[model samples]
Structures are given as structure tokens and as C-alpha cells.
Target: MSAMVDTPAPAPHPVPRRTDGSSVPIGALVPLTRPGWVEAGRHLLAGIESGVRDVNDSGGILGRPVELVVRDTAADPRRAAAAVEELAALGVAAVAGEYHSVVARAAAARADALGLPFLCSSAVLDALTDRPTDWVARLAPAQSHGWRIYGEFLLGAGHRRIAVAAQQSVYWASGTRVLREHLAAHGGTVVEFDMDALTPSAVCDALVDHGATALLLLTGLPEPAVSIVRSVRGDRRLDGVMMGAPAGQPEFGTWAALLGEDGAGIPFLRYLPERLGPLGARVGTALRERLGEAPSFVAFEGYDTVAALADLLGTGEVGRERIAASWAGVAVEGTRGPIRFSRVPGIGVRQWAWPPVQVVDRDPAAPGRFRVLRTG
Candidate 1:
């Protein structure tokens, strides 16, 4: 009888309660970027918005409807930080946005101050992880990873001497620094050349003076980077040498004819091409149908950021405290690989690595179609 009386009471079971109790499911505030950026973001947001709607229509996030709160960050860090604070004011579950690393960092700082969870969609600067803050997370890979890929490929391809060309922009400069470090680590050397002078003539002159075996173009768009490639190739001064990085833009096809065989040595570090599947194709088609353009890395990042946050919100804890706790090791089967927050301080943001790709051939008639060469 005494032994039988020792049975412990059964633990209470969790009663399924609505996670959306007078609270919005999830919200996002994106900095209004350039026309191209805005269009790209719109495409990404379209897919993400559709996905979110699908979830809400099916039953919503824990029975709460999800909402997207978009604000114009104008691609400015100050405005971006303000945008996050404004979103916090809305009592949103989480805030995700901005493609620039600098801007994202600024927003992250603001989010941390407000004790909100942040997911930076496209910022890739490795400097982002210099300090570890809990509220900030990223969805792009580190600059070091991208640079390491470029450096490894160059070294492996027998190009021991490299020169990095950039437009004096922060992004390009950062890439140059990281690439140089990686190149040095691989027993290679990198000479940095400034492309900020804008004119093709001036850029060509600089490249001629700073001759190296290969060139890494770290500018944002294909046009600027391609222009430099064409100028250098046309002058015949940059012949035999290779060009690389962010040059992986599809516009390389258009420049291929101008570059002819010269472009063959050119390679670019495109992140997450593996994720460019049916979803990407569909989003691209829809973007073309509605906006008369296709999505780029910008759009893809935005879509991914929102899609991830919406799914997290669906799990029944939309508050920043709860979401942040879940985010540290939360893995999502993203268009990229498993995107999760690193438990490490500044490095805890989301990061992805993609196999490097080169343009083997460009469509003779198409503007942005290219055949992939040796993906690594």
C-alpha cells in the first residue's frame, strides 16, 4: 500500500493556445533601395508575400494573420535604423531587411537597443561579425567565405598573382581586403587597383599600371564591372589576365561578345546558385510579368528573409525574446543551404556558402543567359 501510494502525478500537458493573441504574426521593413533594388525586392517580396498569405490562408501563424510592414530605408544606414525602430513600435514579432551590410549593422544595433530580433537579408561583410550581439542575424555569407572561395579558385587555377579592381566603394574595398588576405594565406599576392575614376580610359590606365595575373572586380552591378573588363580587354593591355567576383551577374552574356575569348578567363563568385530552382524561376517569371524585369540577388535575399521569419512566426511565439531564443540554432531548408544563427557573438548571424561558378559561354543572342563553367 505504501509503495502504491508513491505514484507521482502526471505532468500537465501544454494546451494549444493561439500564438496570435491580438498581435501581428510577423512584419518586415525593407530599406527602399535603387530602382533595380526596389524591383528586385518587389519580386522577392512577391514570393514571400505569397508564401505568407498561403500560410495565413491555410490557418495563419498560430491562428494569427501575418502582416508585412514595409518602410523606405532609402538604402541609408540612418533611415534603416529608424525603420527598425519604427517596426518595433508596431510591436512586430521580428524585423528583417536591407541589402547593405553597413546598413544592416546599423539596424542590428538599433534592434539590439530595442531588444528586438533582426534578420539581415543580404549584408555579407565579414566585418559584421567583429562583435557578437544577440539580436542581429544575417542571411548572407561572410565576406571572408566569398573571398576565400575566389582566392582558392585563383590559386588552384595557377593564378598565383592577383590584382583586385574596385570602384572605391565600400563593398568593393572590403572584398579587396578579404581577397588579399585569402590570397596571401594561399601563398599568392594581390595588388589593389582603384576604379573610382569612373572613365574607362582612366580605369584602363590604372589596370595597366597595376598589372597582375588576374583581376577581381568587386563592384555591385554587371554594367560597371563589365565595362572595365571590356575596356581592359579592348586595350589589349589586360589580355591573358583573368577577371572575377560579383561579375557572375547574368549580364556577363551581353559582355561576352564584346569580350569574345577574353571573357573566358573571367570567373565570378555567385552565392547560392543551387537555390535558384523552380521557386526562383517562378518568381522571376512573375516579376517579368508584373514588373518587366527579373530578380537578382537582392530580390532573392528579401524573399528568403521574409519567408524564414514568417515560418518562425508560425511556431506560436512571435515576440522578439522567444524568436531570438529559437533563432540561435534554428535551421531552415533555405534556397541556400541550412540557414541558421551562429551561437557565436558577432558571428552568430545567418551565413551561406555557394560553389564558385565561371561563365563558359554566353548566349549569342540573349542578354543575360550564360553557360556555367566549372562550378566550385
Candidate 2:
């Protein structure tokens, strides 16, 4: 983790736009480069851009076309903080978009200090801010909210002994804690597997030694997780041991491309209903066209971020101060469901209270299809 700092250094160049005074610029912070989960960033940006088009097509925010001043955080905490400062300096009305939770925390802290209204698109770390502040709000369900549900699902499935293999991250650590706390209350226990200390085979052995009925990959993609999943699947020693990823790794195309059927049946958290409503279906169609594939829930989160902001920006006064002050009254039919913000207990910033949380997985028979295992 790089040290976070708040200085307005120019980040990546913005997407070319006109100076003709027809657009309203909103600063977008996305992880477009390595170490940042580029796949998720692409979906998030597509959803945001699609939402901008939708808002402009309907009637631009206050009848002005929205312009995105994009900055690639590249999964660095310091970079995200700097991007937020730069976006503020560039006179963006609000800041939005980030897939990584630690990066989002850096951006949130900077935005709070700078008095910028940030509607975080994704990133569900429970403590996004250290103290109460009116400048930041989030559209994603908090880690505790979603992970507790996942814990319940695990318990209901008759798994009392769970093993969590996690990378060294505040986000991952927070998720592990959530699961441990939730599971402990119901006579379930979480065994922590230090990712730095275990090889894929050792992980399987550890699972056998601990008698962990379920294994959760609280890790990053494409290296340890992918290799671990492959190892676990191939090891006949681990037959019938359920695999899980509450971080929602298998929701992306990259997972299937890398793991194929190996990624199947690994239930993960996603914030969408089992079925789409009219608005969700309409937006989903456009997002699918723009992304040229089925968009993930992160995409809807991006779209919902803009939709919520557009409603507030369109209906009333505009500025950082006004936007920050007006979070309590936000109500719009989001692509997921009706969006509303409130101060949740133990959560610092205004949160959507929750989006639809579901535990879904790729159908083992068909890797391209997802099966909704549980919904709440």
C-alpha cells in the first residue's frame, strides 16, 4: 500500500471534449491500467458513459450535456487521492467511479476533506471514511451488509468450518472480519489461510488439515486465486469442498476466460435483483450494446451513480456544497431498484442503505451462464 497524499498532480489526460460550453463535466476515477483490475474498470466506465448518454438523451443535467473528465487510478491509493484532487482542481461537479475498495477509501478521504460530493460507483469496504462527513456517499452495499448475507448462505448450506484465503489488503481483511463475526454468531468458524505462506497444494492440504467445509478466495484475480482454484478442482482430495468468492471475482468475463468451468459454482456477491425491472432492462440492453457483452453489476452501479447524481443535479441547485448537502433527499429509480441514501449505523458516509444483494455463480454445466443461488 502506497502512502496516500492529497496533492493536485495531473493524472491521465481527459477524453477529448469541446470547449463550446455545452457539457457538464463530472470527474471519473477508474482503474484503467495494471494492478487495478482493468476488466472491472472497463465495465464501470462503459456504464458511466452509457448513463451519461441516457441522461443527455432524455434531457441533460439541467439541459447541459455531461462531460466525463476521466482519470485512471491504476489501483494505487496515492494515485486515487491525487486524482480526486486533480478532479477537484478541474472544476468537476462531483467525483464518481472506483472498483477497488482501498483506492475508493483514499479517494473518499480526499473528497471529504476537499468538500467534493462523491457518489462512489463500486467498492464496498465498510469503513470508507474514518469520521462522519457529508461529502461522500456510496451506491454499493457495504461489505458487512453483503458479506454477512454470504455468511448466512454458507451456514444455511450446512457449512460450519470455513477457510478464507486472503491477500494482504485492508479490503480483504475487512471482508474476512465480516465473515468471521457473522459466522461466529451461528456456530461457524473461519480459518485464515495466509496467502503469502501457502502454495496452491499447501492450500489444499491446509483445507484437509483444518477440515474446512468451504473455501473462500478473498484474493485478487488471475494469479493465486486462479491457480488455487485450478489446484483445488483437480485435487481429488478436496472433492465436494465448496469454493466461494464473496468479492465477486467470477462475475467478470476474465474469470471464465482464465478458469473456464473451473470458475463455476464459486458463489460470490453481486448487487442486482434476480430479475430486471423495466428501467433495469432498458439500461441493461444499452449497456450490453456498449460493452458488447453482458454487463456486470459493477456496470449498473456506475450507471446508478450517475442516475442518482443527475436527479439531484437536474432538480435543484448545482455546486459542490449544494450537492454534498442534498444527499438525504435523493430518490430515483436506479437500474437495480429505487435508489435512496441514508446514514446507516456504523457506516460513516451516506449509503444507498443497500442495493439488491445476491449470491450467484456460473452454472457448472455452462460457464457462460450464471445461476442465482440465493437472493436477499
Predicted structure with the largest lDDT when compared to the true one:
2
- Residue pairs in clash, model 2: none
Model 1 whole-model lDDT (C-alpha atoms): 0.60
| TM-scores for all predictions | 0.78, 0.94
Model 2 misplaced regions, further than 4 Å: 1-21
lDDT of 2 by residue, 1-376 (tens): 1232333322333222334557778999999999899999999999899888888888787667888899999999999999988888887878899999999999998888777788898999988987777888999999999999999899989999999998788898999899999999988899999998889899999999999999999888988999999999999989989999999999999999999988999999999999999999999999999998999999999999899988866655545676677888889999998999999999989999879999999999998999998988
Looking at candidate 2, the ten consecutive residues that score lowest on lDDT are 8-17
Winning model by TM-score: 2
lDDT of each: 0.60, 0.88
Tens digits of lDDT, candidate 1, 84-202 = 77777766677776666666666766776666777777677765633455556767667666656666777777887777666665667777777778777778787766666556667
Clash counts for all predictions:
7, 0
